[model samples]
Target: MAIDLAPISLPATADAEQFKDFGREILGVNPGGMSEEQMKEVHDLLHKYSVLLFRDVDVTPEQQYNLTKSFDPSSENHGHGNDFSKTPGRKLFELNAIPGVPQVKLIGNGTVYNHEGLSEAVLKHPSHTTFHKTHVSAEDTAKGITRFQRWHMDAALYDLNPPRVTTLYAKVVPQGPHQTVRYDDGTGDELEVPLAATAFVSGKTMFDILSSENKSVAVRGRVKYSPHPYAWMATAHALSTGLGIVSEGLEMPDDELPLWDEDKIKVYPMTWKNPVTGELHFQVHPCGVRELFVDPLPAVASREGALYPDGAHLTNLMYKMQRPAIAPSLVYPLDWRENDLILFHNRGLLHSVVGELKKDQIRAFHQCNLAASDEPAGPTPEDVRKYA
Candidate 1:
């Protein structure tokens, strides 16, 4: 069954001033001198809409910092800039062009390789280098210019306590269609297999494997197995299922892997619960999840199957069962304009930059992350201590 998300309602005491403070704190954008009643109204609207767009409000770097401080004191800069250089202790993400390719510059660097001057040295080096690479305009046609490409979450590799909120503020808008698209995870139409699917899978398999009673015992036999009893069981499971023993590994056949054709693989419901609000959001990002789990028994029985029949069978079954219920429920078209600043909750939303803007046109923006607040009062210290 699809889970329904009720729209957030505002209380009678909602005011605009309160909202200004809230926005200032969370977004670092201040709407000067809003009354208390006005703040409440804005607060209600923010909770209800989950996004706020401010147009024609030209703000300096310091002012932006002050505004974001209203929500999170630790607001970090997200784009390439020397604008706030004077403000020490402020986190900044610099952007630059990829060398040799004079047209395109590096956006946010991820786990992929960072290259310089079209050489193998750049290809082999890690993507995130300490210093700025170079800046190139789209008109540098001497070298073929390509679009900047990236697909990832803000920061998933880090083990931080509270995930930082991401904010992107547009600084320059070239005469082209370079816009960002966002998907709401809380919407029923965005999810597949429902929240119940995760509950079922976790309860049935993951829980069973972690139980003390289910732990396999060592078999002292002809092959001289290691004293670690679970080693054989774990190894057999990985080889048979092509999954993790202690780490994630891939063994997919080239033909079976997803193709980048227009007909892409169907997305599944990736369930994530907000640590602060305790609300469940359906994630569909293709960052951490490589493929779905499938039933291997039926495919294994077949004598002639594709390369790695067990793996293929498992993946196909999982994908079929977990096809997205609502494909474009949260998608909205982007209308790129000057002095247009848009803010949305990354934790509860899935967004994409879809508009096809040419290489010559520049689309500049700034992004920042909001820090998490303390937990609301409910459970006793002892209850919390148990989890701790």
Candidate 2:
């Protein structure tokens, strides 16, 4: 049997270093009107790249949702029954949508044209408010927490099974250099950085660069994460202590956020196999990990050494493991353009939005996420016996 894929042209600006023969920037095809054959080509290409950039394309919220389904049938996934709107009736999350479209959320920032009615309500959303131009207080930095300036996988905080694909479309973007974005190292060391770009780190490269020992740690080991509440309040409550949840989301009267029980914290294998490509990808969500534990837990202490203490050793190990993943060679900072649509494999990449928006900036992006395909992340009993 032969597979006849649709004819899709990859733009010359698709570039070399970032693509590495995997990613493709399709500026030629009209994804909104792509046939099933072309859609399959896009799907297969996405597995190879783990990231796909579609620039200057005009796709509506509904059209975007339909296009995503062309790749992953599960993109239209419904109700996992965990609350806080998983699928939102199987629709795209329109940050600017008002009056409530059935599946889309109106996360607008209240500055857009004709958005006066929703400005007040949308401004109340945490992502719009509480953003900072620089690190908060010296005390906050010393404690090892700032806003969501670090890299993270989407939905790793709340979803027991996080999404496989995360899509974002730029409806409105803040233009020009901002007056305030800065970097502070907590020791009075600061550097100025431009605002308004999103950066992506390749987990595949992260996995490939590991040493044999760290590679074992990358694949076989386990990493824990803060509970849902702390993960929820990360923007306001990202703590160095790795404990406690203190943010407005918890105190607010709205039911938009979920109140998580500590007993249900997130934990996953350090690496996982992408079901589509069968390629092993480094799986630890860098920002949210509680600690990088050696293979299994203290329950199996009989086989371990006394000198290998927990605490800061594991924390330091987590940082060492993630450092190479953030290097300039592996990280690509996207220059956002108007109507740019990006499809990223949430399982294989770590992404962070750079810069802070002033009160008047119109920088809202539409997000459409596919539901999870695999089990709750981690090593299987087979993995434990083979690697642990």
Candidate 3:
């Protein structure tokens, strides 16, 4: 016998009006204990919509891990690896393990005491100030202005395959007035978002909005990520908007990284095909990518105006291609609530942590993502022929 779950709904906020093709809210499913049938539907929904939110649900750390793992049953490693003790300079993620369920991490800001074998853990949330080259001043921050910390997918970009999905369960949501997110990239773009919201943009939309010439570039391109990406970027500063790193030659040399194997280094397609939708999503993690390789246009395709690529143009090209999808009109800033669990397709969307939290405001969430058993599928031969 199979279980029938309630149908998924669309987000009701006015902000959702801007995005007609993304986000779905699952009404009556407790992800922790879904039946096989229910899980299949959940999986399909996540791929089709890119993001699925389950509000007001109680889930233990172990249950969260189970739910995330169900997306790819063969996967067991955490998206960024379960152990960080060996990597001394990993500043990308501050993962505090839940005592028993080390797979699900407790991430947030402020002090958490005696909750999960962490007697007194003072969590420091990843902030744009620390990572970005230019950030809003303290005085401007006081006026409710903030910046997106970093825009990326939830992949380790290394030995492990990229996770298929990521689950974030909000335990404590701090409340404050909405802040303005300033791009500060000379575009003067800004978005008013809730404090500490996670902003997402559809990768499918990213590909769809591209000009034909750019689309040809996308399907034909591949991104080679740095080995031990987090360690390599430890000393690098990101662009003002956290879109990618500024190429100041400040990256840690390969010799300085954690003895990485050349075989373990990942080079993925610039566009990943959604397993369920068969849609090509422009899914590059600009921050981690070290090189871009573009295949020449197919025989019948017109190369009269196609852009030639090279090693020197990696960051700028990626930024230009991806920046449009994150405009205020396309972004979905998730205003989190306590007990709200969000499961997003890690391969189909790009997300960022927006706004800042004061010291006294305690925000705790359990995040789990399993490194997938395989790499993402890129554009097929047919796809390339059609686009290029």
The TM-scores, one per candidate, come to 0.40, 0.68, 0.94
TM-score of 2: 0.68
TM-score top scorer: 3
Off by over 4 Å in 3: 1-18, 309-316
For residue 244, give model 1's deviation from the true position in Å. Answer: 18
Consecutive 10-residue window with the lowest summed lDDT within model 2:
238-247
Candidate 2 lDDT over 51-166, as tens digits, reads 77787888766776677555456544421222334422122122333233222333434355443234443332132123332335655433332333545676544445667776
Give the poorly placed runs of model 1, Cα more than 4 Å off: 1-44, 74-153, 161-164, 177-278, 290-326, 371-388
Ranking of all predicted structures according to lDDT, beginning with the best and ending with the worst? 3, 2, 1
Report how far residue 253 has shifted in candidate 2, in Å. 20
Relative to the true structure, how large is the alpha-carbon lDDT of every model?
0.29, 0.53, 0.85
Winner by lDDT between candidate 3 and candidate 2: 3
Q: Who wins the lDDT comparison?
A: 3
Backbone clash total for model 1 is 29
